[model samples]
Target chain A: MRIACPFCGPRGSEEYTYLGDATVRRPEGDAPSEAWFAYVYLRDNPAGRHRELWYHGAGCRSWLVVERDMRSHDILSVAPARDMALARGRAA
Target chain B: MLAEKYSIVSVVAQALRGQRGWKPVWREPEPRAEYDVVIVGGGGHGLATAWYLASQHGITSVAVLEKGYLGSGNVGRNTTIVRSNYLLPGNIPFYEHSLKLWEGLERDINYNAMVSQRGVLNLFHSDAQRDAYARRGNAMRLHGVDAELLDRDAVRRLYPFFDYDNARFPIQGGLLQPRGGTVRHDAVAWGYARAADRRGVDLIQNCEVTGIRVEGGRAVGVETGRGVIRARKIGLACAGNSSRVAAMAGLRLPIESHVLQAFVSEGIKPLVDGVVTFGAGHFYMSQSDKGGLVFGGDIDGYNSYAQRGNLPVVEDVCEGGMALMPGIGRLRLLRQWGGLMDMSMDGSPIIDRTPVEGLYLNAGWCYGGFKATPASGWCFAHLIARDAPHPVATAFRLDRFATGHLIDEKGAGAQPNLH
Candidate 1:
């Protein structure tokens, strides 16, 4: 699988580190156990198009939100995670 | 027709009769309305659970639902290495119990599961690692499990073909468990399935569970691709898909799915006698009866439901293999495949009751599921039948994480990939 990093062009998956589902939001400091558990462990494992975080450790060292298909290894889109977070009015 | 018992006399008679007096190992049953216990996923753990539930608890009204064919999941995908060398208090007893069960599995199930007790060797490269292994070996001895701390010369005499003089990560010593070895991965599933079937448990294949039905905070039934099948008790033994299936009942588990790849090299003369793990890297290799070198390394440090892995892990594994056994580099790569691992928070498994009544969980087996098959099945059956945790599995509670009672076996903390 190749990820088109925002900083580095299409690079092999070896150059990046995969952090699971980009959709999970960390719970508040005093949230209940359920909230924390969900944030830490729950995953949808969607078969179709999904968003995930990949760290380009070898090249530009930038965090990217890669939209790829789970069923088929097809990269749909890629953008900086910070930009995606700010666009959604959330903290990076 | 009933399956015939396999024996030398029966085999000779079948040979004399043109070898046609055989029956299907297990019946392919159609879905029934309800059962006393319904186990989701027809892998090794699920089949073993059903077998124990009937043989021990006399709960014969059980159904094992499989999304695919039996033994097509991780049960058949692992590297087939079995061992009981563990350090933690929660894991040593459980795995030791599993090793004992593996020792008697073939006779107990009346099947030739190809259980070879050759032993397992974990090499140490540095002085610090030797000390750590010494501690673990002592812990195993304390638990009455066999463990031997081999010195550098002891290891050299046993396997002199290793890269002993490697400038980096030179050979120091190892921890040996004579009872640790390998088993026929697919045969285990078939043996358990046949035993469970003989005890009147329905073995349903190609039946995918779509949703879990909960009524008044209790699991009552499941909606599958076939139809609605009700059950008094349900067990979620779907290793990689634990999170997805548990979500059907509005429950979230502390599991993340990651792909782990295993590889085999071209058949050659028997090389390694037992399982050997590289101390410097995440590579381990053992020879199969067919002469193929069966081995695997770390899980692809990512969350993936896919059964295929990227090239990076492939390269990394090959490098580790060559570093340990350079002669294998000349062998041709025959085939490689991946299995989704149900990685847990602290690297330990969970075999406890879920929050929803009548629903039990048996998952979070990062790298130890195959070795834990028999014990996992026995303890899970106990939990389902008695509605209480077994004595050995008391620490694998679902609420442990909430109470900060995590069993960090590898000290990997909360990262699933690290485990």
Candidate 2:
């Protein structure tokens, strides 16, 4: 698995730390219990490529936007979480 | 695979017996003469490295030595959370792979450690932050991953306690890493130790290395508590104690020891079911399986192996968690303990081919130690067994500082990442 961070170079996965999946939208207060449940406990566990968050705790300590294959452990791309959303419109 | 029925008692019992249903692998001392590889520190990284070296690469004659119990150091003291939402490219892919390994570890390593895919949300405040999450989410999607930028409404809906509507530090949004979750910190280390031991790796406990014997700029063997153990190759998996060990071989590293603390509240009705953070909130919290609200705040400002933090951090952490989830104000704090963090000059770890030969390192993890255990071993094994830099670790070269290619993550100062 290889991630291309905006700041750091291509480091082994060990340098960066795993945060989790990327699509979970934070629910506003007073949302339904189901929204809270989905937000807290539910996960897609998709088999194809997935978006995830990672921190380069060992490296830059910045949040990373990583695209990875659930089934194959193949990384599609890696970047800072800050830039990931805007780049969301344009798939690299 | 772990039995569906599990608890700390069951886990500890099995570990003490070394599993095959009996034959306790308890502290029975065994004399060993030699091995193919000798790895110091029985923490997760050491055990994992031994596992990869033996199982993945077929290098079976190996030994892992621990000064205390496996994970006795910083590994066990961490707040276990696995994540790959990084700001660096070189590291994202590897951790993503580690996340993949985590998903299958129960089966692959035959350890029932729950790799719960609890989501993690890093909240934001300003438009700049929203854009950051957006970019990160997009990058995740581009790399075939899943991430999305949430709006204020989305954030409020996800975390009801957050005061998104507040005028100050208005809830702009956040970056959610759902694949992230926690694991029993000790189990991860024991799991690797168990698997590696079964694969014919010698795991010597309480065998503290007093000195690293080097010859001709090559690490030759180690002087242990009992006696000197000779080996052709060696690895330093001592995260918190790395600077001391590396110094034994006359290698100077820019690692500083910083104390980190975590607190657990009295068992109570579950409030927060998953991990959530408000960088603005100054705290993060998640209820464990038993309903104890377990969490921690940022790294302690100073250095020490005191195993206790200053009163300021305790107040700061509680205040932060309370601010994020005002509902937990009544929950009593059960205990708080601190661990040493080997903070590197470049917040990123140094896994380079150091000036000394036959020596490899997997330190400088800061607060992310527990999460990156697997990937650290895999990459370190590559560096040790193959004598070449794994593509991702090439950026962590020893000369990065001298060359001014620091990969800085400490936004407060110099490049934490050696660029």
Best by TM-score: 1
lDDT against the true structure, each candidate: 0.91, 0.73
lDDT of 1 at B43: 98
lDDT of 2: 0.73
RMSD value for candidate 2: 17.7
Which stretches in model 1 have alpha-carbon errors above 4 Å?
A30-34, A45-48, A90-92
User: Candidate 2 on A1-92: residue-level lDDT in tens?
Assistant: 34566788877665666555577777889997657645543334333567778888877889987887644456788777877676764873
Q: In model 2, which regions exceed 4 Å deviation?
A: A1-92, B1-31, B415-419
Docking class of 2: incorrect
TM-score of candidate 2 chain B vs. the reference: 0.90
DockQ of 2: 0.01
lDDT of 1: 0.91
Q: After superposition, how far is residue B98 of candidate 1 from its true place, in Å?
A: 0.7
Model 2, chain A: how large is the TM-score? 0.84
DockQ of each: 0.52, 0.01
TM-score of candidate 2 to 2 decimals: 0.75
